[model samples]
Target: MKAVIYGTALQWKLDLRSRALLITCYLVPLLFFALMGGIFTSVMPEMKETLIPSMTVMGVSMGAFIGMPTSLVEIYGSDIKKLYRAGGIPLGLSLFAILLSSFLHLMILSVILLVAAPVFFGASLPESLPLFFAALSIFTVVSLSLGAVLGLAARNQSRLTMVSQLFFLPSIMLSGIMFPQNLLPEPLILLGNLFPAAWGYRLMQGFGIRPLLGLGAILAIAVLACVLLWRRQAE
Candidate 1:
């Protein structure tokens, strides 16, 4: 337990120093929130209700899918993995530490949105803050897990950036955050549903059975990520 705590603290500090992590995790997401929140609530007044939830999903998705993977790739695809072995530390613990640190970062960013939305954009709060945060946490895990899979699978930095963008763009653009999913073609809607962002947005809105589906998707992706990471470690 103490080792885990120490690892987590170290990971947090490293992330703080990482320019890419800071940009994707904090700067970009918060900028989008500040800009998009007003555009959304102004253009479609009714959108105020979903503004916080939608943007929260976007921020978390971007950070987890894009930022986290890049960092992980830098760590695992290089000499850092060797360092872990040399230090007699479990690689899995490092992954968990990264995940936990990311969760807290996303939560802090989300809370910023939760508070600022109402004040700046007249966005309404979720009916149940506890349930909303619960859903957000699950969504974060799934998104970060997907990132882990990509990081483990991609062989190099350039490829990692391209792959992460492929996942990140679709997640935000097709996830009903930017527009109505129904407005898209049926195929696109289905495609969007394949990503966790759609389910997370709905789950945040208190839609029926979405929370369960989101939870299942998150856990399934996490298991897949674990398997992939294990395989990479074995090689």
Candidate 2:
């Protein structure tokens, strides 16, 4: 337990220093929020209600899909893995530490958006703060679990970047964050449902069993993939 905690803390510090993580997780997201928040609210007027969650989803997705996976690929795809084995560290420890560090980074981003949205854009807050944060936590975990799979599965950073977009672009385009899901075509809507971002947006708006179950299912699948990938890398 102590080792896990120490590993997570050390990883957190490393992530803070990583320019890629800082840009993907913080700079890009916040810039997008600052720019798009005004545009969305101005264009739609009604978007103020969902602005916080929508932006939060985008930020979290960027961090998990783009930022976290890069770090994972560095650790698992290179000589670092051999160092772990030589140092008598469990392989799974790296995965856990990265995931936990990412969770904290993402949650902090979420809270910043939650606080900034209303103040800047006159966005409305969720009626239930506790429920909203609960949903946020679940969404972050599910997203990071998927990131873990991508990081562990991809053999190199170049491939990871290409593959990460396969998740990130869809989440942004089809997740009803940029626009209403209902406005999209039936097939597109169905496809969007396959990603956690769609359900996460819904879950944030109003906590419901369906969104929870949807996210739960995604989380389980991602976790299973991560476990399998970790075992393969361990060999």
Candidate 3:
């Protein structure tokens, strides 16, 4: 337990220095939130109510789907995996650490958006902060789990970027954040529903149990992918 704690701390410190991590996890998302928050609230005043949730969803998805995988690919596709195996360290430690770190980062970023939105853009807060955060936590986990699958599956950095965008772009463009899902064509809306970002956006709005189900399905698939990848590498 102590070792895990120490290792996670070290991982967090290393992540602080990573320019890519900083850009994706903090810089880009915050910038997007600031820019888009103003635009949405300006064009559609009623959107102020959902601005925080929408931007936070985009930030979390981007960090998890794009940033997390690139870091994981760098580790798993390099000498890091060999060192872990050589040292008898758990193969999943890196994954766990990265997910945890990403969660913390997302939470902080979410809070910033939550606070700043109302002050800067006249955005409204959620009626239930607890429920909002609970949903955010679930969504973050599911997002990172999907990212783990991508990281485990990609063989190279280029492929990782391509695949991450494949998931990230659809989540952003089709998710109700950019525009109403109702405005989208049926096929695109259906495709968006297949990803967590859509469910996550609804979840934040205090929707039904489908988001929980989506989280479970994504987590299961992520775990299965990791297990298979670990076994294959051990061979």
Candidate 4:
């Protein structure tokens, strides 16, 4: 437990220095929120009600789908895996550290969006702060779990980038963040449900049962995939 905590702390500090982590987790997300927060509020006018949650989902998705996987690839896709084994370090330590560090980073990003959205664009706050954060944490975990699978499964950075977009782009477009899910065609709505972002956005808005079930299912499947990929790498 001590080692895990120490490793996570170290990883967080190291991630702070990583250009890719800084870009994906902080820069792009904040810029998007700043730019889109204005446009959405101005164009739709009604978007103020859900602006925070929408932008938060996009930011978290980018960090998890794009940022987190890069760190994992650096470790598992290279000689670092062998180094960890030879140095008496548990292979899972790296995974745990990276995920936890990313969770913290993403939560910070969410909080920033939570604060900034209201101040900058007059976005309405969620009715319940505690419930909002609870949902955000769950969504972040599910996202990072999926990212872990990508990171562990991809053989290299190029492949990770190509595949990460498959998750990230759909998340932004179909997640009801940009627009209402009902505006989308029936097939698109169903397809959007396949991604965590849609369910997560709904969950943040205080919708019940179905979104929880959807996110829960995604989390379970993603964690299982991560386990299987880790085992494959271990072998």
Q: Candidate 4, 104: how far from true, in Å?
A: 0.4
* lDDT, model 2: 0.93
Q: Which stretches of candidate 4 lie over 4 Å from their true place?
A: none
After the best TM-score superposition of candidate 4, give how far the Cα of residue 141 lies from its true spot, in angstroms: 0.6
lDDT tens string, model 3, 1-101? 87688777877888888999889988999999888888899999999989988999999999999888887888787788889879977767777887788
Off by over 4 Å in 1: none
Clash pairs (backbone) in predicted model 4: none
* Better candidate number, 1 or 2, judged by lDDT: 2
**Local accuracy of candidate 4 as per-residue lDDT tens digits, 1-235:** 9999899999999999999999999999999998888999999989999998999999999999999999999999999999999999899999999999999999999999998888989999999999999999999999999999999999999999999999899888998999889999999998898889999999999959999999999999998998889789999
Give the winner by lDDT. Answer: 4
Q: What tens-digit string does per-residue lDDT give for candidate 2 at 1-235?
A: 9999898899999999999999999999999999999999999999999999999999999999999999999989999999998999887888888889999999999999999999999999999999999999999989898888899999999999999999899988999999889999999998898888999999999999999999999998998987788779978
- Model 2 Cα shift for residue 165 (angstroms): 0.6
Q: On a 0 to 100 scale, what is the lDDT of residue 168 in model 3?
A: 98
| Residue-level error in angstroms, candidate 2, position 193 | 1.0
Report the C-alpha displacement of residue 175, candidate 2, in angstroms: 0.7
lDDT tens per residue, model 1, 121-181: 9999999988898878878877777777887887778999898888888888899999989
Record all residue pairs in model 2 with backbone atoms less than 3 Å apart, i.e. clashing: none
Model 1 scores a C-alpha lDDT of: 0.85
What do the candidate models score in CA lDDT, each in turn? 0.85, 0.93, 0.87, 0.94
Off by over 4 Å in 3: none
